[model samples]
Target: MVFRSPYPDVELPDVPLHELLFSDLGERADRVALVDGRTGASLTYGRLAGAVDRLAAALAERGVGKGDVVGILSPNTPYYAVAFHGILRAGATATTVNALYTADEIADQLSDAGAKMLFTVSALLPTAAPGAAGAGVTDVVVLDRADGYPDLAGLLGSTGPVPEVAIDPAEDVAVLPYSSGTTGRAKGVMLTHRNLVANIVQCAPLLEIGPDTRILAVLPFFHIYGMQVLMNNGLRVGATVVTMPRFDLPEFLRVMQDHRTDRVYIAPPLAVALAKHPLVDQYDLSGVRTVFSGAAPLDVDLAAAVARRLGCRVSQGYGMTEMSPVSHAIPDGRDDIPVGTVGVIAPNVECRFVDPATGEDVGVGERGELWCRGPNVMKGYLNNPDATAATLDAEGWLRTGDVAVIDDRGLVTIVDRVKELIKYKGYQVPPAELEALLLTHPGIADAAVVGVRDEEGEEVPKAFVVGQPGGSLDAEAVMAFVAERVAPHKKVRVVEFIDAIPKSAAGKILRKDLRAREAR
Candidate 1:
């Protein structure tokens, strides 16, 4: 059962990403490229291109090119785009770090990726500085002005020509955004220039975004969904992209109202808020023509309710960090497809439903693990062959580890998860990471972490602990212990003290048994 995309394949360009995105800019030189939602500042197409060229030249002057791995640790901003494209334009790999990561978490990623230089803002220097130092990197450029660090204004002051460097789009790695695939710690996903270019081209026909389109980019650009879909796609199509530094519901609504942005991209958590929040009624969201949710599953009823209230087309998509973030999406004109299902596969994609128990292909309407192969798939996990081999096969089919059922018409509905990675508010929270952190506490003798539904029906990490003899650690203490060490989204939400943790003969924590216990 090798299902294929129903749409015509898009012709992928062989040029570098910068060339694909920056060409023919003179025609729309004065048109707005990006808008700073908070400060109302903007960058016109001409100015953005000029700045990118200057930054690229400056980075090259610093001897960063070709095999160099540079890091960007900043929130969503117009300058974030400049720093990102500048890194790629200089013939270096850009690894975007999560803005909310702690210093140690930041250091771990920078060290693992072997990032030679880091670009950040003054706000994040508190973490970025230490992280870079810990990774033995000395060059850290702050995107915004700081007393002692190089700033974007200084970096882009160069009017010198960017050094000429040869690039093979198909073979050159462009960006490395880390992902916890199936089940493990974060590993860098090696997305080459061609992989990204192909994804943007593949999605264009389905999205129908254009020069007149205005997109609200409240989603962080570090994530693939925002990086490629919202930012890069909008730039390539000559659309106006408005950047938001962080997600504050009132501010988000205000920006949407102010910009009259027609296109909105969000995750499932925001969908819930848009459907049920009281603040949504105060703003005029009438200009929003399309609302596309991805990064996690969306509830059918919630999607319908939001559409009814906002008078917009609402849809959801299926993707992962490894698949250039999109394999299927409910196309804009497919009004008949249910919002709960990720509509037909993208152009140039082939999928399969494999029975995990028997390693056999499953037909339509049968639940099995979803596997997909496409031009947009990553080359492999960086420097981790074991993980790459486990996730991607010789035939190029990526084991998505998601239980899915496809209808005869090719709509995909993600029913359950075959992998252990938990999606907490659309963020991947690995149980193994939490379990390892829990084992470090002296008061905890044994621990197992699993995903449990909260009162609002969102998946949250819950820790089942076996306390040491005469230990005084309580639920709040345990929760606070991990909260201080991890990102806000990865914090433990619930804690339960148990006498013993069930395990298999090989001493593996039986997560299924714990899930069954929670069900009971």
Candidate 2:
């Protein structure tokens, strides 16, 4: 039986994302829209909207228009918002690249997304230039001034009218953010303008941000959770977002106190910090009203403990990169929602529990893989029809590889993830990607990666490596090798040397056996 969201459906506007987000900014012209937490700089709604227009005109002047794919590789910054909306306003698709990604890593995404234009910060030119060269991207623009690069500041000087471009909100892809859906290497998730607009409306009831509300954005915009939930949603509701380029607990807490931030969206690791870290007591977090955790599961005990200490309600939501990244969230003003359970489905979402082995729908309270269908669901994975078909059915229901159980009250409690993707502080670390990297080392003979919980009870990637005979490769060597190749979060935190990796007869690595060994 398919379960539908209990909440009433929200009215989805039939327009492009930029129009939907900035339509009524006239009244909110002077309202503070974004605050750079590091520099203490702020951008008003009027300036943000004007920048979007000018940037759109500038990008269009460089021959960017509909069907063009532009890459954005930067941390969460006020200018990131300008570039993001400006690309969409130009009727081009924005493919957000992780700032932490290495040169080769970012190049793979740029090549796959078929990006023609790229925007990045000057600090990242080392990696960005090489990556752009590899991807055959000639138009590399920087958000800041740098030698031999077109700066966004110069573009804003144009003050020319943005060229008019036709867009089909339902058909035209707006953003392409890569993710390892269910399993395997990262593929671009094709999100339409309608998909994003609907998700913002669907998340409206759960996220009660207003003009007066201030949000602390420690989450990166490259990820869907921060892109949609924090940045886009905050702007859609006219809330002030304080952007943090990096996560430093000291800086995070300081910004929350200094800005008097009201709503904070975080991952479980940071939530655990609030619950146990001594530094949290030093800062005044009393102004914070709501704490919502997503990107990974949150422990009920930890959630309750932090809520009691901070005197604010703590909540958790379940989502994936495919579902515009959100399908379930505990709505605001609902005191009865259970602490551990990922609350009721979001508005206009329908979910089914299907037995993984039989591929048949299961009854409520039974354990099965969760299947969701919603307006927020991605159209498909870019350039990968096989994966797209495997995940999204003909009828549009998305097969989420999460094993869950739904109670009579419609609250979802995730039991396990059938997918092999590891969640490291809200970042998706694909084992396959890491395994491929490990094999490149001359000393490494074989490797299998799995997630093991650390002392803080947060999941981190751990590698079981088998070294070439007489090579004398150690754990530190293996960890350092991976750290240099991948993003900081995807680094192998723990390494265990083994003679052989347990595998099934079908040649699949038995991750359960490795997890069992870690548990012991």
Candidate 3:
């Protein structure tokens, strides 16, 4: 059965970032496009375009050009957006790295993507410089503080208007967002200009964003959710993007009241803030019309409770980094779809649920592996054909290793993940990585990690450890051991002493049993 979008078909613009950011949106230049929440700094669309142009020209002079990969490692800030667009305007692929990544992680990503230049904040320079040097990066542009490296602000002022570079939007990769998808290690998800533009168009109808709209962009731009929805989508519609470097409930609520933000693009954890946090009652969130959550499964009950408190509509979407991060979004104000469903496929996207055991299409309403094929799908994983092949098939369908079911109305509901990846605060936390780290702990004899739901209704990693016979090891000590080594979100929250870790005959850890144990 062929499915069609209810929204009118819109032609995607075939242009580079320079053309899209500067040439296309004329006369609306003075409109406030970005607001820095921390410093109260703001940039109009015109000012932003000018900055991007100047920065692009400067980067070009520094030997950055088309097809070259540039790395941007910074938290969500105005500088991050400027550097990102500048990289794209120079016709180079921008690879976003997590600002919290360790030197080893940063070096691995920089080397894998062959990044020629790195744009990072001053505080991260100490970590980024060595990583860039280890990866043979030629240039480092520092944002905000310019004590040590080449000053980004000075370069932008010195450089002339950026020269236009002709580009094939369909063929040229614009953003390289990394993801592990369902299996293996992290690899760069190649999202072309068309992939991004198409996703924005598809998502626009659901968001109902416009020049009057003000979006709270607390979600990290390094992730696909913020990259496409908050940054790119906000730009496409000339909406105001209030950027926050990190998520703090009180600060976020204060900004919402101060800016009168109309829309919020968030992950599952933020829903918890709206639903249960005491700070929510202190501010006026009356201006907010919609709160859209994605990146992880949002409990239907929690979403409803949040919506009731904020007097806004709650919607959930399903996507992965490979899909330019949005495949399905529940249309605002629609109550027709089931509460837990991720809504129908977005405009111009095709999706199917196939049985993993049989490799055959599952009947509607039957749980199966969700597969997506569309312009929004990524080109491929950068430099890893094997991983790409495992994800994307010969027909170009990207197998999203999520077990889901499609209803008669074409709504999709994600029931489970086929992969053992844990999602903490919408970030992917691979169990294998945590398991490896756990084994190195002196107090632990053997360890297995699994995702368990917490009181706030978000997945948190829980570790079950078997201490050496007669060895003293408690839950607090084990949790502290993992917390020091990994990122905050990846830290093991709940630790349990087990006589033996559950495993299959094939030696694979039975995560389901662990999850069942949590239920008991």
Q: For every model in order, what is the number of clashing pairs? A: 0, 0, 0
Name the runs in model 3 displaced over 4 angstroms. Answer: 1-9, 180-183, 421-520
TM-score for each predicted model, relative to the true structure: 0.83, 0.82, 0.81
* Model 1 worst lDDT window (10 residues): 502-511
What does candidate 2's lDDT look like per residue over 226-284, in tens digits? Answer: 89999999999899999999888999999999999989988765765687667889999
C-alpha lDDT of all candidate models, in order: 0.88, 0.87, 0.81
Model 3, 191: alpha-carbon shift in Å? 1.2
Candidate 2 global TM-score: 0.82
Model 1 spans > 4 angstroms off: 180-182, 420-520
Model 1 scores a C-alpha lDDT of 0.88
Candidates 1 and 3 compared: the better one by TM-score is 1
